[model samples]
Target chain A: MITITGLQKRFGKLAVLRGIDLNIAPGKVTAIVGPNGSGKTTLIKTLLGLVRPDSGTISLAGVSLNGDPSYREMIGYMPQAGKFPENLTVSEVLRLVKDVRRHSGPLDEALFEQFQLAESLNKPIRTLSGGTRQKLSATIAFLFRPEILILDEPTAGLDPVASAQLKDKICRERDGGRTVILTSHIMSEIEALSDILVFLQDGKVFYNGTLAAMIHSSGETRLERAIARLMEGGDAA
Target chain B: MNTTTVRIIKFEFSDVLRSKWVLIYGLFFFLLTETLFRFGGTSARVMLSLSNVVLIIVPLICIVYGTIYLYNAREFMELMLAQPLRRRSLFGGLYSGLVIPLNLSFLVGVGLPFLLHGVERTAHLQAFSMLLLAGVFLTLIFIALAFLISTAYEDKMKGLGIAILSWLLFSVAYDGVMLSLIYRFSDYPLEKAVIALTLLNPVDLARTLLLMQLDIAALMGYTGAVFELFFGSIMGAAISLAALSLWVICPMWLGLRQFRRKDF
Candidate 1:
């Protein structure tokens, strides 16, 4: 479990994360959804230690993440898959990440095989198509058997088949006792996969609970309408 | 973790090497050194000419290339930052990867011409080594300055412009300013004051060091004779080297501090 307390971050005059407090449970899929500029990505970046919070403390399993990077070992992060060392071949990039993580086991190449990345392993990342690069990102995220997975727009460039496969993979990982935190605008994706709903608005947690509870509170039958109701409530307040 | 640092260094080096910019940089130096040796006659003359080139070209290329490369690799750096790597390890690896390859290309490009031109005499060899040392020091200093600039600005055009402008400030504008200062203050006993000012500009210090090695301290052309008179040659050379080292360490230290707290 990851716990964050009073996290705050500002970019120049605009505050991105204003005193966010949250607890992410293990063995569950938590989908963070919000409107544009609602601090969803900022919250995830703080948890990933990408953005340094001005006033906050983050603890993973009771140990503080302050000034320590080794804690990231258990966390597998897949950003938008847009950036790779452009000169490196796909396989070389994979090896570099593997070397960085230094995870030892039988190795988790399940997604690698599923994606059929062998054909383009020798090509430099700059030469790969957008969807191919997306596939590579997904493969690497699952490569090390990380206890926690942070995927930012995991299916952004994926094809229909790849998207279905990835959703199944997320479910499998969640059921296998891994903590998965994802941010996506597709409410149906969250409705199908997530156990926890974290709705952020204006850098604060507007609502944090199960989707059932969220729907019940909003008096809406559907996930999209329920979130809309909550957003209206937030705007009114 | 040490192994991880090594891996990053290895990755960055290979990626940069494949780009072949270093090879082109090497070729430029090789041609310049060869042409200088052919016309300048003696090893002493060639070394002196090359020192001038080093004083101008080394810092310009190092700073420009370093800044451009840093801006291009910013995204890749974010990828690494998300990994389980410490900021220092990533930095150490990148610094080594960039500084080492650039220095090697420089050494080979210039060293070959010097060797082929038969720099076999003891004095010539010593001065040649000193020239190489100056190049290495300038490389370290300028690359660190590049990192400092690149980390401070997020826009590529802004960072590149500032980097080139900084090179101009250090290499060209600085000398112009110093010359006017001397004319304006020629009445004062400015020996110690001029020496102190030289310490502030790394390019002048490097040139002074090279001039002393060439046994033509008078060629400094700016009353650098008094700088020589301020201290013995050996002591003076050591002091200049230490100052260049400070040039490397100070900006690098500040840059690393900025990098640690960087948003990306």
Candidate 2:
């Protein structure tokens, strides 16, 4: 479980996360959705310890994440854009990450075979297309079978077939009792995967609940329209 | 110092080696050294000429390459940031990755030429070693300065500009400014003041060390007399080298502070 309380962060004069308090339970998928500049990425990055908060406490499995980075070992993060060393081959990149993680468990090559990256192991990262790069990112994020998987726009550049394969993988991970946190602009992806929806606007959480509760409260049957209605000041009573 | 840092260093070294720039830099030094030895008559004369080139060019290349590499590696750094690695190890790995290769290039480029030309046969081998040591110090000092600038500013153009300007100040413009300072205060008993000022710039400190090592203080005019009085002894040379090492450490320390607090 990941617990955060009183999380606040500001970049210069612009506040990115404003006193966010959230509890992310294990074995469930929580999708963070927000409009541009609404702090979705900032919230995720703060949770990943990439962005230090102004004042707050984040604890993973009851351990405080204050200047202690060992907690990151249990978490897997897939960045929005997978930026790797251009000179490294795909296999070399994987080796480097694995070397850093030093996990002794059985390697998970399910996604590797699903994405067919084995064929392109020798190709340099700079030559890969955007979709292929996304595949590689997803592969690394799942390689260690981390307890908490945080994926940012994981399906943004993937094809439909690859996208379906990833959704299945997410569901499988959830079934195996791992917490999954993701942020995506695609409403369908959110509807298909999220067990709970957290809507953020202007650095504040406007709605946090199950999809059914959010839809029922906002008086909109469709998930996309319900979020739009919430953004338009429709009170979630 | 641990296995992770060693792994990062190996990864980064191979990455840099593939870029071909370090190889070209090595070749540049090799060609320049060979040409200088071919035309400068004696090894002593060539060593003196090479000191001028090393003091100026090494810092310029080190700063520019260091800044650009840091900027270019920002993404790769972000990738590393998310991993289960300590920030200090990452920074240390990247720093060693860059400095080690450049130093190797310098060694192979300049060191090989000197060896092939029979530096042992020359009476000025001590001067040559001092020159090489100064070149290595300058490389480290300027690269650390570049890391400082790159980490402090988010704007790449601004960082690049400041890094180059800093090199220019140390290598070329600083001497001009100091000369005018001496000229402006010629009668003010400025010998100690000048030594203090020279210590502030690594390039000048290096030049003074090389010149004093070559025993050419008589040609350095007024400031030379002060430098000879101070840096002419073995203890003074050790002190100046320690000061140069501080120049390398201080900026790197500042850069690491910035890097630690920075949001990727």
The CAPRI-style docking tier of model 1 reads high
Candidate 1 regions with alpha-carbon error over 4 angstroms: none
lDDT of 1: 0.88
Q: Residue A225 deviation, candidate 1, in Å?
A: 0.2
Per-residue C-alpha lDDT of model 1 across residues B200-220, encoded as one tens digit per residue: 999898888888877789766
TM-score of each: 0.98, 0.97
- For candidate 1, the chain B TM-score comes to 0.97
| Minimal lDDT window, size 10, model 1 chain B | B218-227
Model 1 clashing residue pairs (backbone):
none
In candidate 2, residue B173 scores what lDDT? 94
Q: State the weakest 10-residue window (summed lDDT) of model 2 chain A.
A: A228-237
Q: Return the clash pairs for model 2, or none.
A: none
lDDT of 2 at B181: 93
lDDT tens readout by residue for model 2, B1-264: 978789889988988898889999999989998999899867777788888888888999999999999999998888888888888889899999999999999878988888888785544788888888998898889889988999989999999999999999988898898899999988798878888888898988888888777778668545556778865657667867888999999999999998888888
- DockQ of every candidate structure: 0.81, 0.78
lDDT of 1 at B168: 99
